[model samples]
Target: MPQTENQTQVTDRPQATKTAILVIGGAEDKVHGKEILQTFWQCAGGTDAIIGIIPSASREPALIGERYYRIFADMGAKEIKVLDVRDRDGGRDSAYLHYVENCTGIFMTGGDQLRLCGLLADTPLMNLVVERVRAQEIALAGTSAGAAVMGHQMIAGGSSGECPNRALVDLAMGLGIIPEVLVDQHFHNRNRLARLLSAISAHSDLLGVGIDEDTCAMFDSDRNLQVLGRGTVTIVDARDISYTNQNQVHGADPISIHNLKLHVLRYGDRYNLEGHQVIASS
Candidate 1:
């Protein structure tokens, strides 16, 4: 129970302000003490929450969608619907559009990042989701592959359990919910530190976020990220890196870099994304 003083106030905002974004690592606890998911439920307006589950990322869309529907329903949500859009056309369905319009909180399930983007990226449905999120009108949560798409520079795929190398990671475009970051989920559990380092070497301008299993990096409207759950959030900041051979290297070769900053934050810890500062847990 790594609760912060103001963590429960996540949904408290001024009129017409933005809501929080919960970026969860894969395999968050569904039973016992579900701190992360519980936090998401409360941030979504609690008993009054009207939630939509987007399971397009999973191969078994209906199965995954129903799974989350039950999770929210059990939390006493006012209404819950699964938006199982498998193709771009499904994104435009009036039925789904209505759910996107009326839902107070939206949750995207984990699966393939490419599949999620292929199905919803640039579609009218995703466009509305973005619009509502940016306007501070809705709370949004995405886990695993869903977390990977929250950045402009996405880590599509790559190897793990290796030294930092130029080719140890793959890159792609993302949904840009938090454009300044490049998110990698299942971090420490999958030994993805090198994988994330390789990613930041390519795009040093964007902060690299490594979220561990069962953990969450909750971002507020002002870009302050707070950690929650059982694991840690690793941040890689290379904005001031002095050098890198990323451009000169070719295929699986070890990369050379300097001045890359990193921070490992646990539950109750906070980091300011705008200022790149750490607010250590008290």
Candidate 2:
């Protein structure tokens, strides 16, 4: 079972980082070809891109690190690097920081989202990485657990069901790369709409996006979002929400809200991140 939240305290400080949040839902199609990764490779300068894979979130760091190593190498990534930070010390290491700082693109691999946040959050290496991204010097991407940490407010743990309730979800602070959004990966397969709605109810100002497996939701700095992959991406807009019982209710009591908007998009579809308005793109 995935841990809900770690002992690490959640803080409200906002990160000024800006970059396209290339979030892939779990189980990307990697073995057959670079269907999903090709997009990342292209954004990373194609053949000239120096890519680094961060596998610190994984339990099997070596294997997970090597997995992307082989994949990116096969796809002609200029250089592939791995930052397997096993502990906070490794995260603070100058050698590891050097590798992360030089990359054209850095990707966080899947496993435990909390594990990734715990190791890198507020570390010297993280500061460097955040600095580069804030300067628009590099691209950043992640899948699964990696994808979950890109938002300012994230869903740390929750139960998936059709019913909406306050108790169905847990919230935690995230990297804030994609500010004002709460991201949920493995969405459609897990039937996570209810929990996602519950999360938005807690903070109605933030947008909620639920990405399905093998899918990627790419966000540019202006917060323009595009969908890619074999499954649908669901958008939950609570900004216009007129009502909610999140504060008035307790426990598993059913939740009610008015004017909560939802949108389901497929590959090649586009939408605006700021307003949750669909963009007419071909």
Top TM-score: which candidate number?
1
- lDDT per residue for candidate 1 within 1-282, as digits (tens), equals 443444454443212123889999999988766778777888788898989889998999998898888888898999998988988899898998888899888999999999999899999999999999998889999999999999998999999877789678889999999999999999999999998989999899999999999999999898899888778999999999999988988887888889889899987788998788998776
Q: What does the lDDT read for residue 72 in candidate 2? A: 85
Q: What TM-score would you give candidate 1 relative to the actual structure? A: 0.93
Runs of candidate 1 with Cα error greater than 4 angstroms are 1-18
Give the Å shift of residue 74 in candidate 1.
Answer: 0.6
Tell me each candidate's TM-score. 0.93, 0.90
**CA shift of 166, model 2, Å:** 2.3
| Top lDDT model | 1
Query: Where is model 2 more than 4 Å wrong at Cα?
Result: 1-19
Model 2, 1-282: lDDT tens digits are: 111121022132111223455888888888654456777877777788888888988999899999999888888989998888889898789887888777888888999888888888888887787777767787788999899988888788889765889889888878887777789999989988899888888888888889998888887777678776677789888888888988988878888989988889876677886566795433
lDDT of each: 0.88, 0.80
Q: On a 0 to 100 scale, what is the lDDT of residue 5 in model 2?
A: 27
**Model 2 / residue 209 / CA error / Å:** 0.6
Clashes of each: 1, 0
